[model samples]
Target: MQSSYLLTLLLFAVNAFAVSLPIRIVSWNVRFDADASTRQDGEKPWSTILCGIWSERCRKPHVIELLKNEAANTASPTIIGLQEVLDNQLEDIKGGLGSTWQHIGFGRDDGKKAGEYSPILYNTDALTLVFSEMKWLSPTPDEVSFGWGAGSRRVVTIGVFEHKATGKRFIHANTHLDNVSSEARSEGIKVVASRIKAVREQFGPLGATLTGDFNSEPNQDAYQTLEDMDFLTEVSKSEAVKIRNLDLTYTGFESEAGFSRIDFVWFGPTEQHFYAAQSWEVVNNVVDGVFISDHRLVVADLTAL
Candidate 1:
């Protein structure tokens, strides 16, 4: 009996000696709720057109429930990077996620409550927010404006977090690249990559993880541009592709046949990676016969090295 007790204590001691606890980071692009006249095929409005006749409550609940269930799946701390979130939708999600959740990022339009936000949501009980900032995906990143012939303004939200369990610090940046111009998508990721250097200069070599909808595929210019940066490595392209994802992250609503793989979860400074990828999952978008979002969420489990 003493031998068994000693073995259990040894295991716990080893785990406690680790630098940082394992964390789950989720990246998703929830489709925006378009105007009544602008709704596309297979795309459903967030609210019901006919309130009483609709079978389910609304699209909002499924999205809320999805995050809630995802958070409950593991005891480890969780943080999420989301794209295509409007001001009102942010309010809905924050309220639905309850008091334990907090986020860092603002709307992309006026830098307040105007447009879409590539927000990073974190669990307050597990991590402390050290610093947070939102920057445009432009040569002049400090200004909130369009760049590289992009139709709309794009932005990235970067946050430094301290793991409460281990007292270690790391960075998380989130963004949504342009879907219209390939040039914009290409330049946008470069700006996001540059933030890595800026972050290191200020924070001094903390590991950085980025989650976003690149819009560019693995073969595209933007993905290649970021790859050439060399320090920030994509997890899916690495040997850590331990578990195969059944479907691509972007579903495009009801189309079961043609989803694209645009969403990504990445960890960096390849030489001194803080979080090593353990497993990857492209979570299903559909629930109870309803699609939660046009794009499915991607979750990655990262363990401290």
Candidate 2:
């Protein structure tokens, strides 16, 4: 009788633990909508690197499949932040993923359909979108104008989500900084931090995750600004790399190892929420010689404490 009672207690504990699973958030730059028909000058030489011989338009299907698998594996559905996505590409992603998935964000050009978008996609079944907004990385963030030394208009997509089963809430922000201007990249992060703080103030204490393709290296001023703030921490710092492969995030379809690690998945305001960094991976989605994007998706698994 005592053994039976002990078994029941153990089972209950296990079940309780299983109910509180960590959320999986992914950050990927889908390389925009540059297919065969729309191939530019730079992509011409790299045509041979694709999976299907002379097939430059098949990456969307692979990307969709990868996202589907991510959603299937996690108990607490996956939230994806995508950059460099055009309007048509967004439609393709949404159609491929089905109605269960929904996204929030707008075009950077006019907040409509002019420029690329840095959008966030969530599983509607597992998460409820409480609030969402888009802010530009400019001095006058409210207006659709570029600031600092930006070459083009850049914006950040912010979403506050609540877990359907657990009622747990968190904030997710995604962006892509200016590629050419160092001033833009540096000032852009500061703007992001301010926005994150504002959202936290409005939504109460919530764990935050910021993901993006910064287009700057770790040692640059932009990264240093984030470090100096001491609020956010890169997820890659905690994980022990299994394979010391090319750390570059932007491969550009070349075999060269000189590319910088520009992509990142960050979680923090560590003092507010205890974040246990689980694993970090630079997913090489180049299957059978086909590349998913020029940039590898940087995925991190984290548990909020």
User: lDDT for every model?
Assistant: 0.83, 0.79
Q: 167-218 in candidate 2: lDDT tens per residue?
A: 6678999999999799999999999999999999998777899999998888
After superposition, candidate 2 runs with Cα above 4 Å error: 1-21, 35-57, 239-246, 256-258
Q: Per-residue error at 100 for model 2, in Å? A: 0.7
How does each model score on TM-score?
Answer: 0.89, 0.85
Tens-place lDDT per residue, model 1, 29-118, is 988767769766666677675634663535787888898888889887888999999988888888989898899999899999889999
Give lDDT: candidate 2, residue 69: 72
Q: Model 1 — which ten-residue stretch has the worst lDDT?
A: 49-58
What is the lDDT for 16 in model 2?
38
Q: Which one wins on lDDT?
A: 1
- Which candidate number has the best TM-score? 1
- Model 1 misplaced regions, further than 4 Å: 1-18, 48-57, 241-244
In model 1, state the lDDT of residue 276. 72
